[model samples]
Target: MQSMEGSNRTLVVTEFIFLGFSGVHRGQSFLFLLFLAIYLFTLVGNGVIFTLIQLDSRLHSPMYFFLSHLAFIDICYSSVTIPKILVNFLRQRHTISYNQCIAQMFFLMIFSATQCALLAAMAYDRYAAICQPLRYAHLMSRSVCVSLATASWTCGLLASTIHTVLSTNLAFCGANRIHHIFCDAPPLLQIACSDTYVNEMALHVASVFVSLGTFLLVVVSYIFILSAILRIRSNTGRHKAFSTCAAHLVVVIIYFGMANVNYNRPSAGYSLEVDTLISTLYCIIIPMLNPLIYSLRNKEVKEALRKVLGGLKKDSGLPQ
Candidate 1:
């Protein structure tokens, strides 16, 4: 709806259009299939990890506990954006209601922030295990692991709630089209009718505190871990120590590296095509790759998957 007050024209936008590579009909069809396959694999792969962690008694350790949480977060993080993107891929009317858009933005923030905290918590777990091996069990007690996981979830929820409430309250009496695949803060803020200075500031502050702060902690923990790994006398010992966290390090580098590039920008200002590609890579591509990274690199996860699949085959009386 449009209203003219004096010479000023204002629009009351109740919905947002998602213009995600829709112009390229053949390309859109190909992308839809590709993303569908990727999303399915992501769900199946992470689900296997989550289930194995839950059911396997030998996997009931601090590291596996955090791995389970990370897997759960991957499922959630992908769910927040992938399904909508998929629906938009199949549908002609690529639109989302204002409330739906707000909800998507809120949950996306929660999952992304929570995953950052999870990565940090996992890093600290590795630091304790590698740097302070003697006291590893004592330091990463079950209670401590639970506390860290709880704190991560709480912090993410708190951070996202602040932004979601504030961002949703912004006046959207302007362009109704969101120029990206999903509702992200940067793109959503682009169409805001109200001045977004305060919203942008809040986002920047949150990025600094929650995203950068957690990442710095991860970095520091790794520094100590690397120092400890280097101090190992035997080459085999060093390799073993480093192997314990190689999977996690790979995950952290990919997840946080892309996130920092996307979120820690100068402002919400971004090119639509470039922003969409990068966001898809950050949000969709990374989640799909995490299971592959962890399972392929970590010995424990591979064994657990083997045993789980073997048991399923046995239960079904199927030849393996």
Candidate 2:
């Protein structure tokens, strides 16, 4: 809640206090442990997936290429917020400096938007594999994958730059309290004393192009994939084709569904507690689940994980 007097005779906020944990009079330690455990699991799970993809030659295809990037993004996305949250859980005041808040918001948006685009790229990879197996090699060459990954990151950077730049222009005055868990655009907008019409419009536009737009891309790719799968005369062929997409489809549904709930909800009628819960699910829980979903659903990832574990066990002279 620190503020400085500006030349315009207005108080400028120097920091923000988070009210996310204000209601908890007890169980701080329990919450800390829970969040820490989930953060560690997210790190390890996604780290393992990335490492396995790098080590396993069988997993060097376009699908796994995109998956490795996804895993990397998950690790980064979770790290951007969870570490600060864990630190705040132990402190009496959940406070963040204004600069830190901006940084957090920037990185958070970058990773989130990148993941959305990356997921769409992965869907296209699946579509190419299933719908046009013969041309899959050319459609998903190494250069193509690199370009897609680069484009995803570029989109994220551009979108984040727009939002972050717009956000910096907002005058916080003396209102330095953030209602939500993290330094997202919406929460910051809610607390800004200045006009936020431009910010809100930017957010809505980014939502359409980055969130909803990527979601529609995924949906369209799946439609073509489904039609392609249906064309296969053999039942087993259809099942195999569908199985390849099942994991990514589930991930797309969960990510976009939670995103819509977290972002697209009406600003009224929802309590702060509900907002906090949805943010936790969308930001904290989803990253941890992504790797688990992929590992559990994909036989190749599981096999690669087993091989790595076995190699480690053998190197340590442990029982097979």
Per-model TM-score, in order, reads 0.95, 0.97
By summed lDDT, which 10 consecutive residues of candidate 1 come out lowest?
1-10
Error of 1 at 196 (Å): 1.3
Mind giving the per-residue lDDT tens digits that candidate 2 earns over 200-318? 88988989999999999999999999999989999999999999989999999999999888777886627878888989999999999999899998999999989999999999999
CA shift at 182, candidate 2, in angstroms? 1.0
Model 1 regions lying over 4 Å from their true place: 1-10, 268-270
lDDT of prediction 2: 0.92
Task: Report clashes for each candidate as comma-separated counts.
Answer: 0, 0
- Residues 199-293, model 1: lDDT tens digits: 88888898888889999999999999999988889999999998999989998988888898888765644676777788889989898898898
Evaluate residue 178 in candidate 2 and report its C-alpha lDDT on the 0 to 100 scale: 86
